[model samples]
Target: MPRFAANLSMLYTELDFLDRFAAAARDGFQAVEFLFPYAFAPEELAARLHENQLQQVLFNAPPGDWDAGERGLACLPGREVEFRAGIHQALAFAQALTCSRIHVMAGVVPSNQRPEDCHSTYLENLRYAAAAAAWQGVQIMIEPINERDMPGYFLNRQAQAHALLDEIGSPHVMVQMDLYHLQVSEGDLASKIRRYLAGGRIGHIQVAGVPERHEPDVGELNYRYLFQLLDQLGYPAWIGCEYRPARGQRPHATSEGLGWLQAWL
Candidate 1:
């Protein structure tokens, strides 16, 4: 069975941030992940994870000023100090929660800065993050968000993500394959997964419907088959459910819409 992890940031809108852990457990999710868990103290989050008997699968290393529209800081030039500091903080939380992976979001490339310049900065930061995380037995992940969803975001394609991971050349560093973004940026979903898996760089995976970004059952992608493929491929990691739980369908609706999850598990 595919190990499904509820994305608390996208789902579970009924309660406060801290309360989502219990909600996920009640809904029968084995694990949970979120955009950023840096808001609460690491100790508090750990307590909730333990109390709910839920595993903390994944979370992004602080995306700089999310409300300010900053997606991530790893690629932004002159932010090396801050990026390194964020990695340290993320690692601390991962250790506290006994989580194994943390995503390093690559922020946008400014108009004045060349893409090459920004790319170099990104690789530099990842090199540092990979070294730091390897020490703690925590893996570092880079996700390729779709251009439509996050315009000018430093990383936007699976191939690009794979190239960067290859350059980093660390077993602890891998790509976060989000199928929703993959459909938007590059098609050939199954082949891409197989290719990345062949390279042994797929650290994590996520799924949602292609255009609408809803529950996997409603979208163009055949998540049922994909889930089975992961199982067949011996993918032994959490597949994050990183989709919006349908607008206006808050609180209990989140659990109501978990039929797909129920079927997959």
Candidate 2:
């Protein structure tokens, strides 16, 4: 059976950030991932994970000024120092929580920056971050945001993301294939997943309903078939539920959206 992980970022809006662990555990999630958990101290977050017996599948390095549309800056020039600092901070949390994967958000490109320059900078920064992560037995995954959702973000296509991973040529650096973005940017989601899987390039996965970005059943993607395909492919990693609730209710009601998944599994 495919392992399902709840994205705490999208699942538990009713609880404060610190309380999400208990909420996810009570709701029967065996594993969880969060976009950013740096707001809390590493020791405190570690304690919560132990208390709840939750497995941390993934989390991200802090992106600068998340509110200002600066999702991340790991690739921006003149920001290497800040990027390295962010990696160290993330490592602290990963170590405490026994996290195996960290998604490195490639920041938006500066208006005047050349594409070639930004790409080169991004490669260098990712190489350094990957090396650092390898020391701690963790892999850093790069996520490609869809252009429609993130207008000017760097790394917006799966092909581009794959190219970056190819250039880096580090086992520690791979791609976090979010099916929602792939569906928008590139159709034929299964083929793309197969290609990445064949090349051993995919490091993690996240998914949501297609058009609505809500629970799986609210949109057009056939997750029952998708999960079956993944099972056939022998995908042992956790597939995260990174979607919003359709009725604006708590994610515990996600069972409604995942009804098909329950039966499929």
Best by TM-score: 1
Question: lDDT of candidate 1?
Answer: 0.88
Q: List the residue pairs that clash in candidate 1.
A: none
Q: Which candidate is the best by lDDT?
A: 1
Candidate 2 yields a Cα-based lDDT of 0.85
The residue-by-residue lDDT of candidate 2 on 1-265, one tens digit each, is: 8887889888766567778788778766788898998777878978888899989999999898899878897879888899899999998889999999999999989998998888889999899999999999999999989888988889888899888888997899988999999998888989987888888778788989998898877678988788888889988788988998775665455444556456644
With a 3 Å backbone cut-off (N, CA, C), the pairs that clash in candidate 2 are 72-107
Model 2 residue 265 distance off true place after TM-score fit, in angstroms: 6.3
Question: What C-alpha RMSD separates each model from the true structure?
Answer: 1.2, 1.6
Model 1 misses residue 26 by how many Å?
1.0
